[model samples]
Target: MKALTMARLLIRLFGVVALMTLNSVAARAEIAIAVAGPMTGQNIFRGEQIQQGAQLAVADLNAKGGVLGQRVQLLVGDDACDPEQAVAVARKLATDGVVFVAGHVCSHSSIPASKVYEEEGILMISPASTNPKLTDEGGANVFRVCGRDDQQGLVAGNYLADVWADKSIAILHDNSVYGKGLADETRKQLHKRGVKEAMYASYMPGKSDYAELVSGMRAVAIDVMYFGGYGADAGLILREANNQDFEVQLVGGDSLTTEEFWMVAGPAGEGTLMTFGADPRMNPEAAEVVDQFRAQNFEPGGYTLHTYAAVQAWTQAAEIAGSLDLMAVIKALRTHRFHTVLGEISFDQNGDVTAPGYVWYRWTKGEYVPAK
Candidate 1:
């Protein structure tokens, strides 16, 4: 009887150990990916856009049995569009064991955070970071879904030369990496076309009043202002100009992609022109996802589709590689063309998307459409 009792206890102990091991395996069967951006600050909407896109993409991937049969676990980080904070967020994601990240919306954030991603052996794809240096200075893994500032600026400068050449044009930047880089490129092309700006200057961002700057443009009788800055500041400047009864056409960069630009500028934003990619929201490949967003009462505008494409590309690359190993996935990304809502995309030797470039957008009545 004693021997039988001991045997029964041993059997129960073995069964418990097997159950624990199975649970452990189940816990390890998920892969961690991250979407990071300014989750808080004046530009918190950017982070929300990144998160929404990533969430829906992950959902779709899981419904398709996930990547390599492993459930994808997503992480979120907030950089507040600050370089230092972005670096910190990258480090945290690394510590969290994330294998992939779609993040760092601003060029200011993306450029710095990319170093951490490279060092940690994580792949990063930016949905909207457009400064050339993010690719020119980034590692093998850094990529963007947006066109470079150089390309965007050329189009903008050429348009200005063609249409607004005779007007008194003033150029202003916010003195950040993205703002200044875009301003410089536009100015370079403007100079190439022999059209000199009436004023080239930097305005401090995050200020409530741009009255002084508006007065400067007014003093110069500036008929047009080419602003290389984010939408919030551009709208504020327009409001200040409008308040002062100074009528000046504001041509801004792609940062004005959101409806927030209109909300900030109000009626003052009427007829404002900005540069952005051809709207991916209008693409045929995007129709299903677009309908999904609309069903949820979300427009999925601006960089939302771009972020979705980033995830889609990474997903396809991982599946092609059949392994989440960094080098293997990287090789797959370089070799394969990914069909996304942004259309078919493939990475170049520099990891830049081999894709078509920029176009002009004009704000008419509260909505921005591809300019005619």
Candidate 2:
């Protein structure tokens, strides 16, 4: 009787062991995290940066056993920075069963994509969308890892107005949502600071020749120019202004900090000032990860650090939620303070990062050096 009992006990123990092993294997199975951005067209570079950063975060998270003990797989969607394309990508990502999404780098793209994610109950965290209206909608699932356009523009406008009070400043925009929005905000702030004699112009995008635009500023004897546009337009405008010997100070937002801006503008890029979300190499907490990204041949850019931080926040929120359910993750993200490579990540009621800040930088000698 004793021998028979021992045999039965051993069989039960073996069965339990086998079941546990299978469950562990299942736990290690691959899971998906979608990254949506402008993977093609003019803004593709920014999208690629966002993708690389999110990939870096996934690689690092997997190395540390990943979220929920499962490996993360990235699903890349190309929104082309178009509103309609963004909605399409968001719907596809939601239908494909991706637990989380980080991208739609452009604000215009993010605005429409957000609705899809919201309706699908997918957690969408934007690393580069800075439009105030994005998070102002009070969508529980919507979160931005960067500062708003209003904050960035206000900072730039105030700085210029206070430091260069006597200079004649001109404001130009590409007439796009982001460009016009930022330009109008900056103009408001500049006006409040008693800065006048400012020329505000909206240029039709895709126009390679900005000779007349630069000449118009010259005609007004403008000394400082604040441009709210992308690198392509800014580069051309700068090159044209330089060619025509406009001889003035030029400043812009994060869009002008790209390498393409320097490549296109060449010597015209000198003295160009801009703003960036955060620099991973300069962030003490992210220095090691920055090295790892560089080792992986990924050059970090403006959205790179923010995207990586967004992934970290998502993973932390998932752990806090104790489940992969989208609503649970969104609730956790709202209530929790996630420690990320970009430092502590927390959001306010408006879905914006708490105390989010932008760094002022200048292009000096073909490099974006932090402004003193």
* Top candidate when judged by lDDT against the true structure: 1
| Candidate 2 Cα misplacement greater than 4 A, ranges | 1-29
How many residue pairs clash in all the candidates, one count each?
0, 0
- Candidate 2 lDDT, tens digit per residue, 81-175? 98999999988998877878998787888988888888888888998888888999737889988888899888987988887889888899888
lDDT of 2 at 161: 87
Can you write out model 1's per-residue Cα lDDT over 87-196, one digit (the tens) per residue? 99999999999999998898999999999999999999999898999989889888887789999899889988999999999999999999999999999999999999
Q: Whole-model lDDT, candidate 1?
A: 0.90
Deviation from native of the Cα of residue 333 in model 1, angstroms: 1.2
Q: How does candidate 1 fare on TM-score?
A: 0.95
Best by TM-score: 1
Please report how far candidate 2 places residue 6 from its true position, in Å: 42
List lDDT for all candidates, in order: 0.90, 0.84
